[model samples]
Target: MGSINYDDSDVLDVLIVGAGISGINAAYRLHDELPDKKYLILENREQLGGTWDLFKYPGIRSDSDLHTFGYAFKEWTGADIAGGAEILAYLKKVAEDNGIAERIRYKSKVEAADWSTEERCWFVTVNQDGEQKNYRARFLYTCTGYYDYNKVLHAEIPGIKNFKGKVVHPQFWDLKEDDYRGKRVAVIGSGATAITLIPSMANVTKDITLVQRSPTYILSLEKYDPIAKVIRAILPKRMAAFVIRQKNIARIYASFHIFRTFPGVAKAILGRLTKSQLPSDIPLDPHFKPNYNPWDQRLCICPDGDFYTTLREGKAHIATGHIDQVTSNEIILKNGERIPCDIIVTATGLKLSVGGHIKTTVDKKTVDPSERFVWKGSMIEGLPNYALSIGYTNASWTLGSDCTAQYVVRLIKHMDKYHKSSVVPKPSNRDQLTQRPLLDLNSTYVKKAEKDLPKAATSGPWRMRTNYWYDLVQAKYGGYDDLVFA
Candidate 1:
């Protein structure tokens, strides 16, 4: 941020914020589709991989398979589940292959963005290190993700200060294994993070305990696909990957449909599968039971039953209860029980953050994000020249992000055709639409911040659906039907 100045005549066409998966995908599409327009990605971190680079824990892997989580442009030929480091490497490869590495301004965090109705542009203020800088762009795409990366979210337990052990959170893992090996540990969550950490460190640690308030659904698939191997050997790499990807995409769609439409059937089948991986002495129902239906929260994917296999081997234990307090040597439960441990892994979840907490102003008046309507789950209502890369909740994050990029490209083309500088979707029939929660999930993270989140119209083209096929049709063939561009 050293005196970086731009000429008034040379304002960027777009300022893509965050160098993570969504930002990178947007950049690729913008570069490919609108070559003449100038654009730059402003990243808060020094690295390409946002979540992958940020979390450096022992067993950090993708909750979803790599095939769909991967960009539509690239094919992931690796195992079904991908490690964090491997995912980072893949992101770097994408940046290098696309020649977008040089276009990224690392360590640049956007603090605020001011939109001028008269100028039809945005004045973005960013902080790089201690230096502050300004950038102007016609459109701002915030791909900063939906969670707070800097601060880990956890409940303040009674006597947490008294715990005389290594207290750790998965978000701030030190990337060191020596500290946890041969130590008794308790992971305080049953989500993807806890599932991942327990499996990766269970064998090395003396004993591991998964302390959960409630259970979540976990599914298992083969880490190495034998069918993929045969297909890859028979056809070209990309072609084989494409065929396998389509098959897997269909499978994912069908699985989500089954989980949502026939929750009881899904629950019974999942319970049976989970029970098969545990010892007969253990009761799988109460320990692994969830009150909500499947897909209410994300269903975690265990690579080749790694989590279940480790649990069955007596290397791990499950403790389901309320945290009464934290003692010097153990965790006191509400039921007068104690879990003694040498280390406590938080695995608690991330705080939801949108727009990077960047203050947004339109014509000097502050824009309350909650008041904005998420049009088509990308553009916000009344906030002109601004768009966000929101992804599918039921499918891979990239599936929606990739389509959103394509949709934005179409929007930009429409703007050009109309010779308009700003475009924001306004409800054609606002009275007819029922505003609902932006995220329809039972996950703790989503629930905590759902009120502060934007609203989506219930019955309109602007409404959001978790189905990838519906989104695909909406994003590809649908455009500007319910929007008013100015």
Candidate 2:
């Protein structure tokens, strides 16, 4: 879509970056809740639906259920786990249905934003259609996501350059019509991506070998939610959806609590469930069991036990070992085992691209976002009229995004009511509080870019954790006293 002139409101009240799942939610909330307030979404890519549009690999589906993965305002009518294309379609539908499409400027990559203290506004620069365009807004909100937009940080294996076979990262699966028919594929890493890729590639390839340093917890998910489907058939569309959504979200959190509170019980429950699904031939000691507790890393889900089923069919294999090096057509394990393959799929993980590489300057000075403390995992300290739409690690992502968007709207309305121009979260006792990682995710992706990420205060308004239930009330309706308004 061509960039609009934005005649109605050239100077928007808010400027949202990234048109992904988080951006779509933010836009819908902004449109319906704050009708009078003008806003526009600046997406770097040529289309909306950030993650969904980007990841086109086979079997690219949501790990989190659509009931919670979907926005609070919008209902996901698909299965519990949806494919990448379907998710993208859902995001686009949300934007189109909510009148957010027109306000989105595709290919409008925001390179830098300068905060003018005198005007109490932000001047944003976007690279659109090979031209640098400027726009001003009262507030700036980012749903750019935590991962690097440019590329996924694939693990750098030694002697990979010497390997003759094609190496590809899931972030940029360039060939749309890629066919691995009769080809031997070796996938590296044991995260969600690898789990999804193994079963998917196995269908088309002769053999698929998943090589990993360690195994991660991969659970089996029901293909559909029968209760929700039954509830929808009986109750009003929206009412049933709301009820089902709330119930599902609660179950997710409760499960998480159980895992944390009673690790042994949780392990046994998960272990038994996994063992029941796996074929008797496959061992559960190392393949299914992870040394870490559940949720230490984001638990991967195989819809209808597809991954295990693939293994049961003898179409796929999981090899847990350290990589010594890669020769022309094989991966030599450090333990002196060599796996032959024609393709190496690196599901290493993603890097944190905080704020989508958009440079932010406060009062002509560059704002080092990493140095500032994050307040409630949504907004950064010392940054006025700005918030980040980071989703939950323990639960579905949209849970946090949906509530955080509402909270942002509430904050904006409060500002308007009091005739205030800016709102910022100021630390109560910065020096006294201990700093912690911005996210508790132990995944390689979150850990890779720890240094560049913002810090959280140990105990204060500046503290943030991944709790959907806590955030629903605390983030959405929490006290505004922690914020400084001017």
Candidate 3:
């Protein structure tokens, strides 16, 4: 990676926070569209890949396929369900190929960003290597993910401290420190992490049990896409990638629409598919059934039905009930059942964070995101020249973030063409607009952070939709009626 010295007085065209998928996408777009612009990406971690680098648990992999998850400029010729390491390698390759690696500064955490209307710039404070540094930029773009990297949702299991065996959270799983070989393990929660871990550790552990208060929709997906393979074989690399990516996007859009429009029919179809994969002894009503319809919350995906295969092989087990208490060597259920194990893996969930918890101020007055509205799902209302790179919940995160990047690039081009220094969203009748949660999901993590996150209006530019097709068109041709350019 290339390093450069920057004086505090030097102002950049754009300052992007977080070197994850969204941040990388933004940097690539800026280089491709506005090569003359000076931009830098500040990553909090020492490595480039954010989530892919932080997570090191067994069976760490993408829940979404690479075709849709990967950027439009890049071609993902790997398996549909890729491991964490493979994903990280792809990100590194993208950065290296596009000369984005040199623009990234590691171990630089943004603490606060204050906007100055008089100067028409953002004064950013960063914590770098235990020392404070300052940077100035014309525009600020935040790609920090929605979750808190330093903290995990606390598991409220009673008497968890009494457990004599080693307790571990999947978020902070230490492979070398915590060994489950030939030892019984009790995996808590039924989210994506728990499902992935149960099947992955099933063979190594004496036995693994998945304990959940409620079940989540678990679907078995193919690891490799046959259609993608055929397209790649017939067409050129770029052409094949475009075709495969579009096909997957359409498929996911249609699937989500069908699930929401005809929930009863969708539920029946999902129920049958799940039942067919599981053994007869493991009933579909309690163990596999979810109270909410599909797509209500993010579905837990099991590549190649590995989770079901483990259950059928008697290597993995499931318990659906509230935890009464954790004993020295057993997890007792409220129904008076005992699950004995040597280790407890709390795969509860993640705590939601917005803007990487960076403090924002406009002229020294604190700006609360929860009170502000999101404009075009990219810029926060009343925030000048600031863009947020957030992704889709129903589809691959890259698709939504890419749309945001495209929109920001377009906005920047418009500003430069008209000799405008800054632009901020100002809805005329904000008080009359109906407010909604920015994130559409009803997931536990989202619900917990609803009041802390930015708001979405019921209609107009302030509304945020998870639809990629609509957002893509808006990004390319949407009008800036609500924006005030200065």
Candidate 4:
């Protein structure tokens, strides 16, 4: 309801960039665990809930179960799988309930962050409205997410730019101005956004073209928000929260493990499910098959065969062929077949942001922020009293992020008792060699920042466990004590 005005010259305990899930969680943890500490969160958007607020595409929902995706301190009382708006509302409540709203500076975009070795703090530069301001803090955390603030619009082959139709990217959906009613809309990409948007848009649009470069593994989810409703009725707030988290965590880990240990088994089961849901003619082959294992890039979810049913009824059509180009009135496939559409929706993918894009300079020399290796995906090797809150790739992000926040809180508390100025992640040589992407294989983000990323050790807990169970084991009780601090 109110706000806090701070002078640019003042220094704070922690300065967090990006008010997304990670940044919000970090601020909440800091406020609750160390109430006396000073902190602030800089958000570029007017609202909180970074991704949730940014994406307004139709039929948006969570791919990960809300149970594990939710904050550890707050219970998810809604149905099992929450929609985007519902999730956004829940996040807003989390901030409001914890009095975190006052600490967030809306519309303030951070330009850069420089580490001052002499001052033992970070100098944060932010652009609020039209004014540039500066803030100093002892610690910095980035949660801007991987997407580079750009809508993913792939080239639609030859003559795409000439197309007279309105082209849109899901990341930059405009609900008010863009009208889909009675228009033939072609939604590209087979990922979650395209799958979800296609089914819903079919109801209003004249027809829908579901285009894709390759086929992705599609699965059905529980359509209704059962978890939220059940918790609201029967359980106390705290207990309901705990049960939801535990249940979701168990289910995710169990499923992830089964898929990882037996890829063939997962493929076989999922294959049957897919065939039974869609038409038999739709080829599910090397085109749809991922070069890596399942759960590698995230499986797309369509609750209760909504997407399949939409296609079956003829409101939507799935185009598996490659695109050759876009003309003024139609999309031409590599096979030379042209399909006419009034609007085009591209849901290609998202950019991954690590450490919220904080720029760090040491000794007046710019350290390519992407060059430093990440320690346990949280702390950078050479940075003191700094932590990155990246989450699990397979499981819900909140599961990993919340755990990381708690660990950081505890670590901070431990340091305070000894009057320590910093707590750095000093990994052994073996540990450094073993660190790998939680999910192996070349991802755009991992490959782009590999040189700056910590070399994952091949052995020990630090070796990089893509499995949820292994990560839980390590984050909970294994090898953490070995991280040295001075």
Candidate 5:
């Protein structure tokens, strides 16, 4: 064991965990709003960009448009749907341009954070380069997002171990080593990853089959927005970006409202659009038609109808059935159909996690997040000077996270103005509040991690809203009288 190093000489004004999009947004806000405050970003990985850096599979692109997903401080003058490498480069440029890159410490994984009432600070334990170190901070911010990075959701398939071919998960894909040229590939799952992989690998592989247990609502969107291009040509760069961003945001809000309010109409429109793109031989009934209404689960997006184009080109096929077993050379379906495959790619899903699985405690008493309630969709109840940067389920992730960053900065400013040392959300009638799931989605991953997540409420600040417009307004001018500040 290495010697534990404690740095008691310096205490950060704010300590942010995870150096991804959320963390980078938070850092920029702090730097711009509170320049005097000391802060640092601790990233567990060797690089930044969080999800963009983690996923290296082929045809990996943003589901949301870059104008809305990109930070408000910067203008994304590229295509709406950008690849993982392009997004990562954008993030790196943001960090470098704003001096955030210097504040980031790579390979620093937060293990535990304990708040001490006596010291009025959080004692954080971290492992850096295989050595344990300790640091103190006046405020703690968790921007780790809501999913597990080290683990992926396991799909159960009988005789998986008996298969002799290569089994790959998108989360752990290595493009350099995994060769698919002229090889028959079968990708399991109908989510975004599978939709992306089939289109991307169709040209290189001999034949690609998309195997799904159930269909998900998928829509085709233009890769480049013509309206955005016209706006950029007419207006100044910053003005154009702002206008385009607002336009995209309104479109997202309107589409979601329509889907939830008029499910039948939305379903019919989606069905018609899908049917038009797909070949006549491939029936829309079994393969494309999803049982659940749109937005019940997240809607998958394929830029420029790439997935459908691949299917129409005879390079890809769709198999909608439950997996019965896996043989050495093929996948056997419960319907007695066997699909030959040289490589099986499991694009199943991610495993949900809260606060990046960091152990949290207050004066040695363990803090179970499931028991606590979220306050203003940013801070957790009964937690001192702590804030969570989570995004919206129905819109671009950065919009909600940016709202959180603004709210946190406001809270910090309020604390500084009143000469307060700490602030915590302490609802008087905590036990009587009705509990709701923090994430409003009904997806498999969200449902599986419900018991491990924090609780929301039916009303007041304890309730969490997925509306980006409402959240933006609240973050800017919401009152904090319900909070306990000292």
Candidate 6:
């Protein structure tokens, strides 16, 4: 940890926390919109790129296409739909290119932030290099993504500690050469992490056993878009962004509409595809089949049918069952069967919490986030001089976050116009509203954090729709106008 002394005379207009995708974008937009307003971005890590830099597993790439994952203002020029390292570098370059790096205080972790009702400012306490310091800001902005920042873990298997094989979580993958080549590997979970790792590890390892409690429905798309290339050649990069975004959104929407409204049609198409890929005897249970529809819970994308292709080639094996226990060198399935493996990759998934383990307090009183209402998923009820950049659970995260940023800039302009120092969300009936997790969909992160999250007011504006077009209209036109700042 590092520390810096703040001069009391200089009160920051805004304090941005976290240096990840959301934070960087917020800072970049803030400086671009309000160059005269003093703002400081504080990050706990020595480096930026929160999750991308943190996870160093092999074959770590964006689950979504790079076009939507990358910032709206910037273009992703490199290859492979943006892998973890590439994305990390891209974020770093964004900071360096815009001169925002100088404004970032590395290794400065915000220990506490107290809001003052009388003064209408936030008393921020942060630790740096083992030293604690204090500062004050008129507004506070947090972009620290939802997840446990340190050591990601499984839900604690009965005898996990007794396992003798090399047990590793994708979150803490060691980059050094701890060879898994020629070794039997077992990958747990059917999420993006497990699915991606299973097929890829098959080539390196002797064999890979994909252990899944349930099956994940996967869709394939071209890694690089021919149309995107053509558009990039003809139009400016930003213009291409708008066109491509619309095209992708439409494609996803059409696919999902069929899956939801016409289940028979969706099943027929998926059934044929599954039959072509797998043996007829293999069961495709509709129980594990998603209830709502595709794109309801994120539609997992696989380019070139990589996972399917590898499975058919006899390199990888999929095992769907409950693991009874971990043996010294193998896993015991619930059906009195044992599967042996030399290495275990628990892609069991990440724990989700807002702001990455950040604890937020107002006026020195511990605030339950659930008590506040989320207005447009950016402003929290009863909290003044603060804003959050919350991404979409169903759609592209950057798309939604960027949309929120656009709204944030508008809100800032509105505040400036009125010479207002603070803006808070005031709900008509806070207790009467039906509150639920922002996203009730059964993904790992959603399930983890849904219980304690803040809700929307009156369920209409607060009711989050994962639909891109719906959010686009709300963000760009409808819902933003209704928000009262005064």
**TM-score of model 2 vs. true structure:** 0.96
Judge candidate 5 against the unseen true structure and give its global Cα lDDT, from 0 to 1: 0.89
What's the TM-score of each model vs. the native?
0.96, 0.96, 0.97, 0.89, 0.97, 0.91
Where is the poorest 10-residue window by lDDT in model 5? 1-10
Worst 10 residues of 1 by lDDT: 1-10
Worst lDDT run of 10 residues, candidate 4, spans 437-446
**How do the residues 339-446 of candidate 4 rate in per-residue lDDT, one tens digit apiece?**
789998877666545555556665466766454456666676667767777677777777667666766777677668978766656556643464455345344434
Residue-level error in angstroms, candidate 2, position 87: 1.2
Ranking under lDDT, best-scoring first? 3, 5, 2, 1, 6, 4
Ranked by TM-score from best down, the candidates are: 3, 5, 2, 1, 6, 4
Model 1, residue pairs in steric clash: none
Better of 2 and 4 by lDDT: 2
- The reply for model 2, stretches above 4 Å from the true place, is 1-9, 176-178
Better of 3 and 4 by TM-score: 3
Instruction: List, residue by residue over 1-486, the lDDT tens digit for candidate 2.
Output: 223345633788989999999998998888887877788999988999998888877788899999889877787788988898888888888888778998888888898999898999998888998998999999999999878878678677978998898888988886443567788899999999999999888877878999988888888888798888899999998998898888988888888888989989988998998888788877888777888898777888889899989988999987877899999999998889888998888888887767888898888789888898888887888888998888777888888888779889988988889999988888767879798887787777788788898888778777676677777787567887578998
TM-score of 3: 0.97
Model 6's lDDT to the true fold?
Answer: 0.74
lDDT of each candidate versus the true structure: 0.84, 0.85, 0.91, 0.73, 0.89, 0.74
Of candidates 5 and 2, the better by lDDT: 5
Segments in model 3 whose C-alpha atoms lie over 4 Å from true places: 1-9
What are the runs in model 1 whose C-alpha is more than 4 Å off? 1-9
List the candidate 5 regions with Cα displacement exceeding 4 Å.
1-9
lDDT digits (tens) for residues 1-486 of candidate 3: 233455535899999999998999999999898887889999999989989999999999999999999889999989999999999999999999988998898999999999999999999999997899999999999999888999997658999989999898888987652378889999998899998998889888888999998998888989998888899999999999999999999999999999999999988998999999988789997887888988988888999999999999999999999999999999999999899999999998888876998899999999998899999889988789999988988999899999999999999999999999999999988888999898888877788889988999998898886799899999999899799999
Tell me the deviation in Å of residue 134 in model 4.
Answer: 1.4
Can you give the lDDT of residue 309 in candidate 5?
97
**Could you tell which candidate, 3 or 6, scores higher by TM-score?**
3
